[model samples]
Target: MTTRADGRKILVVGVGGLGRAVVEEALDRGAEVSVLVRDPDKLARSVDVRRLAAVTVGDGTDPATLDRAVAGVDVVVSGNGAHKRMAREIARAVKRNGVQKLIWPAGGTNAFADDGVTPAYKLHEGRFPGARDIYLAHQGCIDAIRQVGVNHVIWAPGRMTARGARSRDIEVKVDRSAGMYVSYEDAAWVIVEAAVTDAWDGHLVSAATQTGG
Candidate 1:
């Protein structure tokens, strides 16, 4: 069950916590990692911008830029969880390039069988400002993938926390574990794993940090 990204070419979209982790993990595993980001300068502040194999600076939502970026890479992993609007474009690029898989971690707080159409998704909007918009966009991303018939692995982690390290201590469950928390690093490891495998293909995954790890 040890699938690695060694020698593979991957395009990771986003520079958020999870995105950064995914890029770093892919690099460590010997994959040629390219990133699609709005601001290339900001990458140095979050992750080592130098270690990346290629850096495409542009708007990922733009079909032209996205399609070009996806054309050369073997797989695409979108860790830009909030840029829910970019999923459809990414899926289009993947389809055009003949790529079979697109990996993304979406709906962290609303990771459930219902696919975030629950009351909890609504509840977060009040608990946190602009939560509703983010959640809605995420749902749209999911729907777009389905509509486009793109083969993808969408992860809905119970709750992603800023804490913890890349110990590879990940546990995926069938359904929501309401209290489960996925660390950014651990989530990155699994996301990179998804880049090269069909184990979780065409499914919505629920992953979190192993409680006892």
Candidate 2:
């Protein structure tokens, strides 16, 4: 498949926290943005949700709802949390729709050992017993999406602190060294970049930066 650098018809499933940020970023890039959210009112509270090209409210796990949410979109992004079952369903539906391009969020523990990811992040994973499992579930969703024939790029951000300095100029890694951490704001920036960047496809990207906040 040939790659292009145009803004896209993007449906971002999940509209809470990070998901909402992804939708806003897509809109900022001049993309036709739509979102699938569980609560219409909750989403409407966000300044941008009401202004999106389209918005659908329902459980993203249901095929019928996913069909409605995903129809006619070029890409689907599952920014929902690991515990959110709809994350898997959204991935599957995107593939079933034949829109193979997808970008999803992951945990820092999913990084490849040699991907320039920080050693501290990997150490954090190993230090906690279920850290690997927490990250593995995110990978499992990526695997399921791939099995369904979707081209996916997964993103993981290091420990995010709410410092209120939301800036996008942050560094990301596919490999890490040590002493790396990212802010939630920076993580969202990386996710938006992966969603819109021509270079991001069929890859799992992680971010740990020094400049955010």
Q: Each candidate's TM vs. the true structure?
A: 0.82, 0.83
Which parts of model 2 have CA positions greater than 4 angstroms off?
1-7, 83-85, 115-122, 161-169, 175-180
| lDDT by candidate, in order shown | 0.74, 0.69
The local lDDT score (0 to 100) that residue 11 gets in candidate 2 is 86
lDDT tens digits, residues 1-213, model 2? Answer: 212324578888887667766676667667788988888888888745556888888887898999988889887877675743556677678877887477877677766566444433356655677776776776677667667666777776556664455554565665342233666666666666766665667776777656535
Query: lDDT tens string, model 1, 1-118?
Result: 5577788998988777888888888898889999989887788788887788888878878988887678778889887764645877888888888877888666754455345445
- Residue 118 in candidate 1, Cα distance off native in Å: 8.0
Worst 10 residues of 1 by lDDT: 172-181
For model 1 the local lDDT of residue 61 reads 89
